[model samples]
Target: MSDKLAILGGKPVRDEFLPYGKQCIDEEDIESVVKVLKGDYLTTGPNVREFEEKVAQYVGAKYAVAVSNGTAALHAACFAAGIQEGDEVITTPITFAASANCVLYQGAKPVFADIDPKTYNIDVKDIERKITDKTKAIIPVDFTGQAVDLDKIMELADRYNLTVIEDAAHALGTEYKGKKIGSIAHMTEFSFHPVKHITTGEGGIVTTNDEELYKKLSLFRTHGITRDKELLVNKEQGSWYYEQLDLGYNYRITDIQCALGTSQLEKIQKFIDRRRELVRKYNEQLSDIDGVITPYEEVYSNSSWHLYIIQLELEKFKAGRKEIFEALKAENIGVNVHYVPVYYHPYYQKLGYKKGLCPNAEKLYECMITLPLFPKMNDRDLDDVVKAVNKVLSYYRK
Candidate 1:
């Protein structure tokens, strides 16, 4: 313990501070970026298409559209799904703002669904209660890498004729009932941020099998322009001629990012395997701690373990979650809260949403703490995290 503590200031236990999540770079990743940098096209090129095709194949979808980021992917998905003003999209409150903001982008209202207390994903039962004639879709977030109960959500979607666009930012490598996550939903969105299962610096993809939807997404990604001479209502009769089919933003991803993404995709399995191993170790080490509740995985789900979130057992803690969090930070273990209920934000609150709308999400928000878990962390780092957590728990546990 003394030597480990000395390593902290002597040089820093990590080459840099251990972030909760980060990109895993390797020799192949570097070479791929260099190749793209030296290539002819930088953006809207063949590599973009190749990356899309590879992702589509990997996720078992018919088409994949690369975009600037996950937010852009969600925006395109919402637009293609036909979300409009007065239309409502129900989604979990325990996700990044993009999950709900995408609906707002299309001028649709975002309805919040409370999460399952056990799985911390959207509660299907609660989602059913929020549905109405104006409800057009449900964006179920695969929170923290655990696959949402797509079967239940799909059943509801089938009953209501609502589209299902999965917010799979945290679930790039997750599986549900033996099927890959993107394949199980009508439309699936993936993120390639540094913290995600893979990295492209900042990139995302939309995957779907519906040809019409795929066409819409394709055009929506690049200023609504279509190179397809066939879709032109009036052709210039030249190969270079193209047309803007509708109002769309320039959400195209660069070749450099795609190159990195494609390279990162190759090591996705390794990243996921390592993350899963770390999660297992955390679960085992924290299970017996009186004030900590480890993450839960559904029997039918195989998670990518993008984040390892734990809930504080309020009954067992004397100082509450905030105090415990600060204590861990003081010990040099980076800890963070996953989210504040989306409705609790000022933007949503302005829209007539309130604190009590999703009680489960609010309750979870109070106790949720995201631990540092990444492929770069070694056993010593793991021990530091576990020990820090234990030290905090012992100090606060009643």
Candidate 2:
């Protein structure tokens, strides 16, 4: 092992930088987008409906509503769940801020639940403790593409008469107890960001089996304006007549994006397979390394493998996390942290949240690093990442 760290003038493992995640775009994806561009309807057209139907069918849901982005999907789900002022929604803290911010959008309070240290999902016991009469919904996130304890969450929701909206942004192909993530939740939301399993530039969709929630999602996406004759309260003056039924935003996604989503969805299984393979390789190679904790996969879950995060035993390392992170970056490995606890941010701090709210999430954030694990990575890339990690850890060993 080298005496000096990579950041301290030692030879680096890689000559080029490898980002933690990336989009896998193919010729077919480009061709689909081009086809949509050449067509007449660019926004809110047949392609959008087709993409929604395809997603709903793939996830075994009765309906899906495609929207502008993941944040909008959460917002729409909250709206459909009837989240309002003075309402409280429970969710995990170790997720993207959008998960909790979506509740704030509905003028509701986000009651953050602590995580299960082993699986890094929200602890059901903590969730149960946080529940109250004012709790209108529980928005459990499928963190790092692994399904949360959905059966337990659903049971709690049923007992308390609360809605469950699954924030499945990282779990496009994840499964729980043989059911797809989107199929089992009361309502599930998915993101089509570039870093996700599938890309549509930037888009989102909500899936549900309830017809009432489906109608509400559809209405919420298009400024609450519907021309459906049956939904109209007054007699229609003409075929072109439409009415605004509720206060909603214009969160409609373009058909161009939907076309790309449709094409990307065709290869989602292959993408997931590649990601899982990479994760397996990571586990096999990194498991024996001292002080390195590989992610835990629950028996009930088949994770989509959106991220491959490793937690370092901080007590065993001579260097701090920042030093290790910088050392890895110097080796041309684009490592990143998944998140800080949502309530630990400055905005949330100003809103009366403090640092020690979720101790497990805070502790996880301090030592975890996300490794490069995109579907586009090859054998050489994977080997290089492993080498860099090992080299860095060896150098910093206590």
Candidate 3:
């Protein structure tokens, strides 16, 4: 191992910090938000419907329901799918907690499934093995924006008479076998957080082709209230009348955020293109480096590249993940870990989940590091990230 330290003698790659992921906003995004600020309605208004329509058309889905945030979107989908007490939903453990927590929101059990180690996605066979009589749904997450094997998952869902709700928060522009992700699944959820492909400050939406599911999602998003005359039990109650059909939450998003989302959606293709370009550059630069393993992309799908993750060969390094992570941070590179297996969390453990549930996911979590990848990043930013990673690894190599 090298004796020199960047903190002591060598110059850092960058003077400023570079975050793992960030939103790209411009004049148009600002202008759109300003327009909404001056509009008639800020909460549930025309902009929300227009944004939903634009997203539906973009993803080739028939209907879209905008919600407060990604977690809300997942909860709405689970509720719409009729996930109740005693139901089991199989999903990958190598994802954000919200992916599994949504199942718990409906008083359903979330069954942890191991991931395909190479692709870092839920294993299809593992999903099949986890299914039982109580299984009512499968919530396959598109980890790091790579689309899950929807065909296989859907086949399993069909065989078991189960609903498939895709947690596609990381994948907005991703395509699988020449088809958009949102259009393929029974119901798909998207996030518009600052780190996601698009931003509405903090917002999410659920997309689907099923009309009944769409209706349920809409109702659930707004406290289960309905104003449509056709759906009302009491006819001729007057135009001012509304009714609460079922128990639901107020997961509604404001038009101000939706306006921003609509603007960001217009540039989504460009954003995705830039992210892909950066991933390609990172792959080319780091693939042959010792003790480093770049992300793997399956042939059947094109990833939106939400987060570019690298797996470290810990056996070949004297330093552990925490040391390397700190080294990168010392060089002004903002790196992160995508997740800690959902079942490993204290709350999940309290709910009867344990550490050994998904070995592959736990193993992956031990070695993986999320690097910076955003549309706003230039060649210099990419170079700095690559340089910092190389410096850390070389100094720590055994």
In the range 1-398, model 2's lDDT, one tens digit per residue, is: 76466688987888889999999999999999999889899998999999999999999999999999999999999999999999999999999999999999999999998999988899999999999989999999888999998999999999999999999999999999988888788899999999999999999999999999999999999899999998998764799889999999999999999999999999999999999999999999999999999999899999998989999998999999999999999999999999888998899999998888788888999999999988999989999998988899998899
lDDT tens per residue, model 3, 1-398: 34355665666778999998888989999999899898799999999999999999999999999999999999999999999999999999999999999999999999988999999999999999999999999999999999999999999999999999999999999999989899889999999999999999999999999999999999998899999887898978889999999898999999999999999999999999999999999999999899999999899989998999999999999989998998888888999998988888889889888788888998999999999999999999999998888888888888
Regions of candidate 1 where Cα sits further than 4 Å from its true position: 1-16
Task: Residues 16-80, candidate 1: write the lDDT tens digits.
Answer: 34568877899999999899888898887888888999999999999999999999999999999
User: Which is the better candidate, 1 or 2, if ranked by TM-score?
Assistant: 2
Q: Report how far off residue 92 is in candidate 2 (Å).
A: 0.7
What total of clashing residue pairs does each candidate reach?
0, 0, 0
The lDDT of each candidate is 0.88, 0.93, 0.93
Regions of candidate 3 where Cα sits further than 4 Å from its true position: 1-3, 7-10
Residue 176 local lDDT, model 3: 95
- Which of the two, 1 or 3, has more TM-score? 3
lDDT of 1: 0.88
TM-score of each: 0.95, 0.99, 0.98
Candidate 2: give the clashing pairs.
Answer: none
